[model samples]
Target: MAKDKIVLAYSGGLDTSIILKWLKETYDAEIIAFTADIGQKEELDGLEEKALKTGASKVYIDDLRDEFAKDFIFPMFQAATMYEGQYLLGTSIARPLIAKRMVEIARAEGAKYIAHGATGKGNDQVRFELGVAALAPEIEVIAPWRSEQFRSDFPGRAEMIAFAEKHGIPVTASAAKPYSTDRNLLHISFESGMLEDPWFDPSAEENEEMYVLSVSPERAPDQAEYVELTFEQGNCVAINGEAMSPLQVMEKLNELGGKHGIGRVDMVENRFVGMKSRGVYETPGGTILFTAHRKMESLTMDREVMHLRDSLISKYSELVYNGFWFAPERLALQALVTESQKNVSGVVRLKLYKGNVIGAGVKSPVSLYNPDIATMEADPSQAYDQGDATGFIRLNALRLKVSAGVNQSK
Candidate 1:
């Protein structure tokens, strides 16, 4: 009888390599390695062959960039999601889409089990498993980092390295760089290693060497560059007057934002597993989008609608950050978020300089602003009536004056 198949989310990285080896040896099962190509650039090159060499029975590489941007990223941006008031939620938003694709591949291949390389201590375990449970509840999830058998077999990175050598699997990791990284279209995140310390300044040589998508702000060019982004119903449709796909829009912004040293953040955040982790992120294109998207909303969104949407920003951000992308609450919130963006279509001009994205100008066909009403230099007979403010102020102040008079009598 043939062994049962297990589909593993393989990245051609050190941790996943160890998992692939262990899965084959322990279960004697057929291992099918999967890599999602969500804009990791050239890192996907040679991955399929590498997985086969590392004991995978077969390999699947799927290009998921356009879906990643349009379905996942654009919706998150439409809601104006930001985690902990600073993070753009780049890494957090990519998890569900990857998990969704993994589940789909498992069903197609008739795999009974799936595996991932996320550690027990990190948020990814929650993210990967929650997605699995939601999408493929019957499929068993094999998490090597949390398994006692795997941990006993290889105590740490050194043992895993030795096991790879014994199996003739070439690995690129070193002891000096203990931190693991995950990269996709939106951002790259660095955690563990020297970054574990909250006080550790990331400007150290070793830390600087890890950057892939952006440069240091100090080294950015002296000149500034301007770019115009056009949105259609909350989706980025063009850049600098040229029509482009979502993937192309992100690529253009990444190039421009990287050149200007934009989008670098270091923060200590509360993890879903009841602990805090320090992470450094580089999200060049994501930062540019956040800035320009807000400018678009300012022009097209109604005042009360913007305020109501802003009220949900915290809860919405927490759901994304906490691995609840497939949860019912998040889906419902997204429905409202999507409706709120119906009129958010416009062009936002921005100035990109060293580590800064400054709004240059914004305009939209549906803009609520009227020069006749807003401009003090406009004729009093036009648009808004200035005389209406007298009754409006008295009506609003009635309760305040009553409370003040009652207090004075006491």
Candidate 2:
């Protein structure tokens, strides 16, 4: 009889590396490690060899960078979605895409079970599971971190390190650096370890190695550089007048923004599991995209329409953060968001300085900014009558005046 196969979303990290060995030993199942290459440059180095050495039957690394930026990142960018008004949805948006690909690989490999290294405490577990539920409901999810047997066998990181040492699984963990990090093309996230202390300032000495995309702002370029972004129906299509693909546009922005130290966010956000966690992120490309998009919207979008869409951005962001990418409510909200961008076509020029995205200028074919009506230099003949303001003011103030009169009488 053939043993059942389990497809693990392997990052070749400490947790997943240990989990691969444990799954093989404990379940007596074939382990196929699947790694998503979503722009983590060196992180993918020797991952396949590492996974196989760590007891994986086979290893598959899929480059989902272009698809990730074009399909997933751009759509969310169109909505200008930000979780908790700060998080750029870096890790949140990537989870569903990874989960979708994991299910695809599982089906192809004839695997009945899929596993992930997402911890029980984080929002990622919910995101990964919910994505699998939506995409491939038939495939059973085997989350070892949330399992009693696995947790009992390897209680913590220390125990896992010991197991790795005993089993000859080469790991990079040591006493000096203990923080956990997640990195992709869009951003690099750092949390846990020394960051567990809410009051702890991320010291330069301790956290200097965490930066993947950019150097410190103090070391950034002294002179500001201007970049023009062209958008059509809310999708960024060109950079500095050169037509480029979505992926290329982001790549260009990442280069420009990183040099200027434009996108670094350190915040303690409320997780989906109701715990506050500190995450330091570097989202260079995404920062430029958001700033440029907003500038374009200011020139082209109607005031009421912009306000209405802004009201729903929090809900849209929350849905994505909470792993409801495939949910009906999210789809419905996306429809509104997409429709709101129908005329959001324009060019926005921005000045990038050390950690600053300053809006230089914006222009659009759909611009509602009429200089004739807005400029003080407009002809008096074209203006409205000043005498009509008397009745307009009086009528508008009547309720307030009446309330004041009643209050005074009382």
Candidate 3:
């Protein structure tokens, strides 16, 4: 008789390694481990060998960096999506892509169940489960952290460590690292552990070593550097005269932005799980691209179209943050975003100085700003009629004037 097969989203981390073994023991099933390389750097090293040694019948490490940058990061930036007006949604955005690939592997391997290491108290479990439901409704999810049997078996880290030791599964995780981090092409996020304290200062000198992608603002170079970006249809196409693919663009910008200590944010944001979580993030490339894109839009995007699109940004951001990337409502919002960017082709220059992305200049062929009509000097063309302002102001103020008169008469 053949055993049931379960595909697990494995990172070779302590939690995932333990879960890999636990799933096999609990279900008497064959375990296939899958890892997605979306630019997590050196974390991918020796992952396959480690997974196989830890009892995975098969292992897969897929590279999705290009797809992640172009399909996910660039599209989100086109709308300038930000959660709660500050966070770049770095960690929130990566979950769906990871879950998407896991489902594909599950189907190919004839696995009916997909398991993940996301804890029930956090948002990632919601993200992973929702993504699987949306993409493959028939597949079942096996989340051990949320399972009563698994929770009862391993009550804490001590029990988990003992289980791994008894099984000879090597683990490097320990209490030494105070916070947890998630890294991708777009950004690196640090949260939990010491960061859970709302009043704790991540910028303190003691915690300075925690930042991975950027230097401290105080230690950045005094000289300001200028960078030029070209955009077409709301996507960054080039940087400093070098035309590059989305992945290449992100890599180059990350280097530049990191040198100047740009794109560091620390804040307490409301999570979809109804709790406030504090996180520190370094999104150097994303911040630079976001600033440049907005400047370019100002030059070429129409007034009313920009206004209408801006109104939906908050809702659009919420959808992405809450694991609705595959939902119908988000697709409708993205359609409006795409139409608004038809004319948003332009060049923007910015000055990067010690974490500041300052606008230097912007120009576009389809620019709506007519100097002749907007200039303070005498217009020989007589482009804008000065006399038109009288009726424009009177017509707009008529209702206000009537309301005042009614109040006075009363």
Candidate 4:
């Protein structure tokens, strides 16, 4: 009888490297390793050779950077999704894409079970499993961290390292670090291990070296740098007057923002699994784009439409954070968000300083700002009548007057 095949999301890392071999041995099945290249930088080097040598029957390294930036990152940016008003949903957004691809590979490989290295404690477990269930309901998910047998066999990183050596797995001695990091085109997030303590500052002089994307604010250049962003229907299409694709725009912003030491965030946040986790993130490109996008909206978006969309920010962000990216509610909300951006086309100039994105100027062809109506000086056009405010104020004051009378009677 032929053995069942399991498709595993492999990341050429210690946990995934061990999981790949363990899955094959425990299940007595063939393991097909799948790695998604979403701008991990140099992490992709030797990934295929490493996976095959470890135990994977076949290896796949799909470059999903363009799809990730244009599809996932851009749409979320349209909604201005920031979990808790700070997080750019960087790590939160990438999980669905990875899970989506894993499902595709599982179906293509005729694999009944799909596995992942996401642990039982973190949000990735929920994200990976929920994404798979939403896409392929019939596919079985194998979470080794939740398995007692797997947990007992490898109690900690030390035991895993031992097993890796015994099984001829490749892992450097420095693999066991003080914290863990997840990276993609949008951002890089650091948490867990030393970051579990909310009081521990990752930006301290001693610990600041851990940051990978930007320099400390104190170390940034004395002079501020100016950048210009051009947007079309809420999507950034160019930087500094140069037209480029979504991926290219992100790359340019990341470069400039990183040079200016921008987009570093440290906070204690509520996780979906009923826990408060401390996370430090570096989102250079995302920060620049978000600021410029909102500035553009101020010029072109309607007041009521922008307000209604703003009201959904919390709910929309929560949905994405809690692994509901594929849910019907998110889809419906996305449609409304997409419609709201129809006129959000404009140009915004920004000043990037030490850890700051300040607005320089904003202009739009569809600008709702009319100098004739808004000018304080006498306007011959009389587009807005100053005398019209009397009746409008009196009518609006009626409710307050009635409430005052009622309160006096009480």
Could you tell me the lDDT of residue 157 within candidate 2? 82
- Candidate with best lDDT: 4
Tens-digit lDDT track of model 3 for 1-410: 89999999998877799999989889999999999998888989999999999889999999999999999998899898988888888888888999999999999999999999988777888889989999999999999999999889887666777788898887755566646677889899888677888899988888888999999889899999999999999999999888999999999999999999999999998888898888899999999999999999998989999999899989989998898889999889889999999899989999999999999999988898888878899877797889999999999999999999999999
What TM-score fits each model? 0.95, 0.95, 0.96, 0.97
Pairwise TM-score winner, candidates 1 and 4: 4
lDDT, each prediction:
0.89, 0.88, 0.90, 0.90
Please identify which of the two predictions, 1 or 4, would achieve the higher lDDT against the true structure.
Answer: 4
Stretches of model 2 off by over 4 angstroms after superposition: 203-206, 380-395, 402-410
Where is model 4 more than 4 Å wrong at Cα?
Answer: 165-168, 172-176
Model 2 lDDT tens row, 203-231? 36556666778766777888889999999
* Collision pairs in model 2: none
RMSD per candidate (Å) reads 1.8, 1.9, 1.6, 1.5
lDDT, candidate 1, equals: 0.89
Positional deviation of 297 in candidate 4, in angstroms?
Answer: 0.4
Model 4 residue pairs with clashes:
none
lDDT of 1 by residue, 253-276 (tens): 999998988998889988889998
Off by over 4 Å in 3: 156-172
Candidate 1 residue 272 C-alpha distance from true site, Å: 1.0
TM-score of 1: 0.95
